[model samples]
Target: MRKQPPTYSPQMTRMAFAASFAFAITAPAHAQSTVTLYGIIDEGVNYTSNVQTSAGHGHNLYSISSGILSGSRWGLRGVEDLGGGMKAVFVLENGFDVTNGKLGQGSLEFGRQAYVGLSTPFGAVMMGRQYDPVVDYVHPLMPSALFSGSIGAHPADLDNLNNANRINNSVKYRSANYGGFSGEGLYSFGGTPGSVGTNQIWSVGFGYSSGPLNLGAGYLVARNPNVSFFGTAVGATAASNNFGSSPVINGYASAQSQRIFGAGATYAIGRATLGAIYSNTQFRHLSGAISPLNPAGVEGTATFNSIEADFQYQFTPALSLGVAYNYTAGNNANDAKYHQGSIGADYAVSKRTDFYLIGVLQHASGIDSTGHAARAALNGLTPSASNQQAAVRIAIRHKF
Candidate 1:
């Protein structure tokens, strides 16, 4: 009788204790969430010699440059759980010029990244201004990782395939990582009313990384990329031709749109990494007046074939050295040829900081136009001004 009385309520007693423990454990997790504020601030001094000014003047100029090592920016990112396997996610990022406190995202404050979406085991779908999949997946695997950008980046970063920039009014999709292989696709709403057919772009890209090998490929086609780089626009006319806000009078006029598709890969062995990339870019539907010296209305199609090889080695955990060689050949519709070569290096001061050095050498042959020298001088700059130029930059970058 005594033993039975003591055991009578054992199940009820255990249930009461379990409820108290669960309440204590879940109270904090339910009452509070986490938000992270992060950003990067990078700036430095840049020196370029033989900076071609006007039609026939080369001047050595020293100035403060923004984003030589990394673009300056600040952003907010957050997450909240909705229970089960679902969650709410959002990010708002703004790019700025550290030297002048100017907004980096065109005229929009949040031009760098502004998006909200749902994330799950299947994948993620996001909307707003965003980075093209090609830049996100492909450029990171190239020598540009150490050089800060691809040598193949087009004039004024007019296109994203080389990771020059991002686009507006876009929706993006990213697949969850599957054993180091993932894919992404993006569609950018041209946002130009009746001009829809002539002012839009679309892209798709993929990446696979396993062990010491990494590979990426992507394709991009724009209806009128040349218009922005070669056309005359307000505000641009006032700035230096190097900036390309307008078309210069007495200057060469070249209207050509482009389509680029290519693949790149990298291999890591021991303390060194080796990288290579091949890109094919074509310019079509060309029409423009050559330099005033010869305004016979120049028109020609151009094809560019570029190949690059790069190497990086860690001298120590904090000290590393990198070198890259890039070679490119341009064949115009008339089969005129232009060739360019480039090399560069970088050093890491810490996980979130670094310094860099780079040089480019270019030579063109078989072009028959007064603009040929101007084109070479421009080094493909939007306004095109260098017959031959060299740049050496030193910068410091910090991330939080």
Candidate 2:
């Protein structure tokens, strides 16, 4: 899940898929250069309870899904040494579904990442489509990422702990590690003519590591979040729909501005690791007609706060187990509350392959972002027909 712009970023890996192949060559004057190829394949069988339908009702669902634990993808990475502790680097990552063999990330080629920049002892600065600072820093420390994956995310991945969105026309900076401390800052241009405030996003994040302790924090703000952060589609509400219809964030789709802040810490003790994370998401100046996002057409600011605690234990060299609990509370649109839990077990067959089993359960209460009764909604899936939802998955992931 971590893409190294300069191949110097910190990563908290726990059975995480990371493998690559490099080809080296001699450039003019013997300037060493290298190009790498990397990819991953993930497929799974899933069964979910109480999936909601258009009639305001629901049904159970069973299907084969791709990229459960991690999105299936491939990419090319190149680096050329320029002498004196400096180098030039570039990456082109593509996301796709193993099942349908279709592009992911809104069907954009190289949608996952496309950037190039110079790397020095200080850091690397790249411009292109890229992930925000939160995804670079704090997300790796979240339970949804380090262990159980997407299903473990707070309701609807409201705080973007699941990388539901990426920034376009962006320049990002990743700092060199100093005394176990590193950081990132990102800025995205709106690219909208005549309106600088229409679609702009900026973020900053930092992390610290010492011994077995890891800590991370990040803050992000987006203007015209619907078009800037969600997706810049043609209609007024079309862009916001890119984030999906989950009540947790739907109503705030038309928010004139959005802000997200998160922090977390993880520590390892013996054969076990434990972590906790907290996030705050706020949408200001909601606007739009009575749609799925704004069923009540309420005009006001909305806020959601979430926290999660997770634990993982290594039972053996090849097998590990994880569990996590998450809570989210919302106000303004409605006083909604979401409680979710996840259980996961993974067995490593080799350095590049693993099998996993995961179970997730969720319960929701109060009014939702849509102004209706809250419903259990897991990240990357349909909302539950009822207030409670349960799901199970068995999958395999291979990296090459």
Which number leads on lDDT?
2
TM-score of 2: 0.90
lDDT of 2 by residue, 108-149 (tens): 889788999889999999998888988887888887776677
Off by over 4 Å in 2: 1-29, 232-240, 288-293
Stretches of candidate 1 off by over 4 Å are 1-33, 148-162, 192-198, 226-257, 287-300, 334-345, 364-370, 374-386
Lowest-scoring 10 consecutive residues by lDDT in candidate 1?
A: 242-251
The whole-model C-alpha lDDT of candidate 1 against the native structure comes to 0.60
Clashing pairs in 1: 232-247, 236-245, 301-333, 377-385, 377-386, 377-387, 378-384, 378-385, 378-386
lDDT (10s digit) by residue, model 1, range 1-400: 5555455488888898999999886775784544679998878776566655666566777778676445678999877676666667788998888889888745457867888877778778888767777677767766655663432243223234444446556678888889999888877665667776564667788899999999998877655553332222223332232223312112222433557677789899999988887777665655654433224355665565667787878777866666666555555643333344445556677888776665555443444233343234322232224444455566677889
Candidate lDDT (C-alpha), each: 0.60, 0.85
Question: How many angstroms is residue 334 displaced in model 2 relative to the true structure, after the best TM-score fit?
Answer: 2.2
Best by TM-score: 2
Clashes in model 2: which pairs? none
